[model samples]
Target: MARTLHLGAFLHGVGHHSAAWRHPESAAERLGDIAFFEESARVAEKGLLDAVFFADGHSVNRTYTAGTTWFLEPITALSAMARATSHIGLVTTVSSSFWTPFHAARMLASLDHISGGRAGANIVTSMFDAEARNHGFDALPAHAERYARAAEFVEALTALWDSWGEDALLVDR
Candidate 1:
């Protein structure tokens, strides 16, 4: 028998398309509703999805090249989704350009602990001008510079994650 592939919902506001708001099922009006996101994650869990993925960026893409839609901070949203559903993996993005390795390491570790080791971080180095401006930088960090920092950031996170041995959490006092 052929193996069946597992599916994970890469959720975006209401839906993937920027114009999904015009559709009847799209809940564009409830962008800030935690219940809306929780319910959607539950529905996906009910479908036995392998995971739910949330995209992250430092700043909103407000250029309007595509229709405007709400974008929530990924790590925070994914942490909430973790509480809403069990067994479905939670993946979120963090930009290397805007955050330090220590910050990423601590948060990801907390998420992993909270979610029972099911947390995954989608590391990125933001390159958009708007994002740079948001971080008080005059220009977007150069691609090579961003990548170099990202490499170090990931390395530091990995080291921090490994620094704690599997048995480090033993409570045998």
Candidate 2:
């Protein structure tokens, strides 16, 4: 028997389509509202989905459609979703181009622990000039350069994660 692949919904600012917010099916008004996300997770849970993934951006860009503009931080939003659902995994985007290794590791690990191993961090190399400016850089790095930095970033993150081995947590009284 072959194993089936788990389905994860990559939800963003109302829906997947760029113009989804303008559609009747979208809840554009609640893009930044915690309750909106909470309810959406609930719906996903009801469908027995494996996870809800949020694609993130570091900077605010021009919005041709009606929806959020780099608002409602992913980690914080996932933490809130963690409180609302139990079984569904909460996946958040973490930029290797911007965040330090230690911060990424700690934040993801903390979210994982909070949600009982149901947290996942989607690694990304920021490719937008706006994102670069947001991080105080004059411009976005070239693809190869970004990947080189990303390699180091991942290595550092793994080291940080390994710093806390499986048995490192001692809650014994």
Candidate 3:
């Protein structure tokens, strides 16, 4: 197979750099606007980009005075993005530490159906004690434990995703 480069826009709030929101051309105010996300997806598609990815978090670890942080839940935001573009893949980070495999599988499966199979995921074990606290952990789990949970999470999601047969959702009797 021939090697090819894959480019995905990070599509962070305003921009990746903390100071980007201060730029004259930056659409900082449009962070929560669906049109902003839709327009961004359109632009990436027009550029022939391969995908647009959104990173997510469960808790606020950074002060707003310091820098921009992502607000929209990745799956929800990407679900909206899925509606605005035809070809660009919609990818997002999903924390295995916080989300159950069944929930992740259900949401991603819907996204895949919505986007004509352009949905993708970057599963993560997550970082920060704040995020851990939000999910009911007293602190971040040990590294080995987190990785082991992540592995199991992936296995469960894969099983859930592949569990259905073609007729699973059949309406015709």
Candidate 4:
């Protein structure tokens, strides 16, 4: 058997460069449009990529004036993308620091079902003080603390995701 290389498209607004929004052909102004996201996913699918990844931040950075800084919520946007494409995986950044394990598990599980198991979660221990403040923290936790919390979050989330056995949702009537 031959090994296969999996590829993922990181779909950041237009491009990943800070000045991508300034490019003449960039669709920077359409960051909030679901159609824009759908098109991006479709293009990724056309390329035979295994997944399209969406990065997310919970707070508005001060750099907003320089370029495109915000976008549609990741999980919500991925739901639309799931509807728009098949075969390509849908993955989103979700901060363990800002969300409860239950919330994350439920959302991811729903997205997984929606995409026929093509959904993925890119969990992060967020480092921004602004993200901390938005989640009710006065300051960002120490790196070790953040990682510790992330470990627990992942453990709990995995348990929740596994709570449902594979045949739990059988639909015989």
Best by TM-score: 3
Candidate 3 Cα errors over 4 Å, as ranges: 63-65
TM-score of 3: 0.93
Candidate structures ordered by TM-score, highest first: 3, 4, 2, 1
Across residues 1-173, which tens digit of lDDT does each residue of candidate 4 receive? 99999999998866787888888999977878899999999999999999999888888776543466657888889998999998899999989888999999999999998888989989998757887888788988899988999999999999998898989977988
Worst 10 residues of 3 by lDDT: 60-69
lDDT string for model 3 (1-173, tens) is 99999898998887888788999988988878878998999999999999999987777766542356787777787888888888899999999988889999999999999889999999988888888888788898899999999999999999998898978886878
What are the TM-scores, per candidate, against the unseen true structure?
Answer: 0.88, 0.90, 0.93, 0.92
List, in order, the clash count of every candidate structure.
0, 0, 0, 0
Candidate 1, superposed: residue stretches over 4 Å from native: 1-4, 64-70, 169-173
**Tens-digit per-residue lDDT, 16-50, candidate 2:** 66676788766878878998888888889889899
How does candidate 2 fare on TM-score?
0.90
Q: Lowest lDDT 10-mer window, candidate 2?
A: 62-71
